[model samples]
Target chain A: MKTLLNKDQLNITLQRLAHQLVENHLSFKDTAIIGIQPRGIYLSDRIAHMVRNITGQKRIDYGRLDITFYRDDVQSRDIQVPSDTDIAFSIENKSVILIDDVLHTGRTIRSAMDALIDYGRPKNVELLVLVDRRFSRELPIQPDYVGHTVDTILTQKVKVYWKEKDGKDEVVLIDKV
Target chain B: MPLSVKHLLGIKELTVQDIEQIFQTADEFKQVLQRPIKKVPTLRDTTVANIFFENSTRTRLSFELAEKRLGADVVNFSASGSSVSKGETLIDTVNNILAMKVDMVVMRHSASGAPWFLANHIDASIVNAGDGINEHPTQALLDSFSIRERLGSLKGKRIAIIGDIMHSRVALSNIYCLAKLGAEVTVSGPPTLIPKHIESLGVRVEYNVKKALEWCDVANVLRIQLERQHKPLFSTLREYALFYGINKQMLDGLKKKIIIMHPGPINRGVEINSDVADSGQSIILNQVENGVAIRMAVIYLLSGKKDAQLSI
Candidate 1:
């Protein structure tokens, strides 16, 4: 396992991403932010907090989306207990930004897109990721906002850890021997 | 893990973990039901045949809707006006259906173990919709699902299976399922209607309906199987209703909030009063709604598509 981003690097990347979000979404009136469930939630929560701090916004509409049922590999894997999806506000005619920790197969993003439609049709949707594992995407999905781009093989797995969840914030790439 | 069994023959064949797995899958499908599209292309290439030798409206329609919603090609086969009426054997009829490249068979037969028998003879997956008084696995599953939904867990919860225990497949299946899930089960009914050796199944036997109601957290009232009864178990319907029937007054008399559940085709005045069936405490309608999702979960898991995902 190789450590790609330590605590300092992770914090710097989050601030940069939050600043970029504020620059593009400027008051975020008709904009909504959603975090992919299980892993993406921590990053989305961190970014949402950073964005609120940087933009001085009172409340940024953020929610969690679970794409377990919408995935392309339901039966093959062990039965999964689905996480809570708590989208309280409507995404109708809003600019929606979907956040995740890692982008590899791109199937998770595709499932997230499919699941997002069930809430309501958004005017537009964009993707943001903490780690973009280039050349391994199964679907034609590209992240609009990327924190780090790492070149990895199909055999390697990239994981992001947060202090709130893992007691430390770091991104690691585990390679199969 | 995904269910290890190739076919869902009965609740007897399913472990507690298997039932929980099915419920977890159903939970996901329940959310799908709430969506606007209300359909998922999960079983796109799969084909299922609903073969009912006995007559049914709710179970048949529920299974059909589940199959359709999961994007499976469905073929409905009723025994009436078919080869079975012309004295064809069960295997012959199923074999003929299987010849059509049917992937799975959802069967409801008048005779017990019909699905099990078919499972042994055929290569296709067999799901027992209901097989006589033997077991109705899906009904039991949905009942447990509804209980878990309302109460949050089944462990050590008190459930009273009221009325016709002797002839109820729901009672048998529920006994196995609820007991396996760590619920305290009590079968309450008149002496003749309560099956023999039921206590051996690890449930208390309650003779008085009022006392049973007072003891249980949930009362699953069942309709007296009028068609299945060759000899009269009770003298009159009025006498049974007066003694064992669940009504609003009886519920109010309990002075404790208890969830009311009934496997459908309820004998309105005979087993349960119309008012109580439609009351605030009743989860009968939720049971019906959950039936579709439960069936979809069963069909999806049994579809045997190792890597298939929900599409569209």
Candidate 2:
């Protein structure tokens, strides 16, 4: 296992991502932040919190979306209990930011895109990820904002741990045997 | 996560955890239904056959809609105007369908334990739509879901199952599901319509519908199935309505507001009056709406039991 980002480095990365978001979505009017459910929630929650502080906004249109039903591998994989998809606000004609912890094969992003169609049509969607596993994407999905980019083999797994959920904040690459 | 059993034959065979798991999953599907593009692609590769040996409208259509919403390939079969009338055996008919690469079967039959027998013989997962006075597991699930959605939780909730308990697959299923969820259930109807020794199922028996309505938080009134009754259990439909039918007057008489629910095809003035059925406290329509979500949850979980995986 190789540690990619330590405690202090992870904190700095989060702040940088938040600033980048505020810089692009100044005043945050028609833009909505959506965290892909389960893992993406950890990263988006922290980023959304930091953006709220930086922009001095009380609350932004942020929601969590679960793409389990939209996944293509339902027949093949073990069906796990789905996380809550709490998109309480409308995303119609709004610039949406889809956030996640890591971008692997891009299948999840594909599923999330399909899942998002049910909600009102967004003006546009941009992908944001903490770690982008370069050269591993099966779909042509590219991330707009990336904290770190890593080149990894097929068997290696990228895992991001949060302080709230995993007792610490860090990123690690595990070589699956 | 995987459901404990391969086939959902009856609620009696499900543990409380399994029921809870299904409920939790159904909660997610409920949100999916709210979306403008309500269809999900999870079951695209899986084909389901909805075989109804018995006639139905709501339950059958509910299952079909659930299957369609989940992106499943659905094949519908009915006994009437089918090969069943041509003296085809149950196993032979099902095996023929399975031969067409069907992965699951949703069935409703006139014989009790029909789904159980099918589950034992077939490899495909069998969901019991309703089997002759046995257990309509999904109906009970959606009913409980509707109650929980309205009243928050089922634990310690007083739910009175009123009317035609002896002939209702729904009442039996509801009793098992509610009891497992720490809910107190009561079977209330005319003594003749309710089965003997039903109290052994850990439910109270009330002969008076008014008394049951006065006692419970929710009254899950069941329809008096005239077709299922071989002989007249009660004197007359008018007399039955006068004594047992739930109406606006009963709610006004009750000290507390009691939720009213029915599975479907309500006998209108017989089991429940039109006024009460259309009342503010009635969650009968919500039960129908939740049926698709509950079914989608069950089918998705059971589909996970397959050992197949994409070669990634």
Candidate 1 residue spans exceeding 4 A from truth: A56-58, A73-82, A164-167, B304-312
TM-score of chain B of 1: 0.97
Write one digit per residue (lDDT tens) for candidate 2, span A26-81. Answer: 98898999999989999999999999999999779999999988888876667888
Evaluated at residue B108, the lDDT of candidate 1 is 99
Using all chains and alpha carbons, the TM-scores for the candidates as numbered come to: 0.92, 0.97
Using Cα atoms, each model's DockQ against the true complex is 0.39, 0.78
Superposed Cα deviation of residue A30, candidate 1 (Å): 1.5
Q: Give the distance in Å from residue B74's predicted Cα in candidate 2 to where it truly belongs.
A: 1.5
Q: Which regions in candidate 2 have their CA more than 4 angstroms from the true location?
A: B305-312
TM-score of 1: 0.92
lDDT per model, in order? Answer: 0.89, 0.91
**CAPRI-style class, candidate 1:** acceptable
Task: Give each candidate's fraction of reference contacts reproduced.
Answer: 0.25, 0.84
Clashing residue pairs for model 1: none
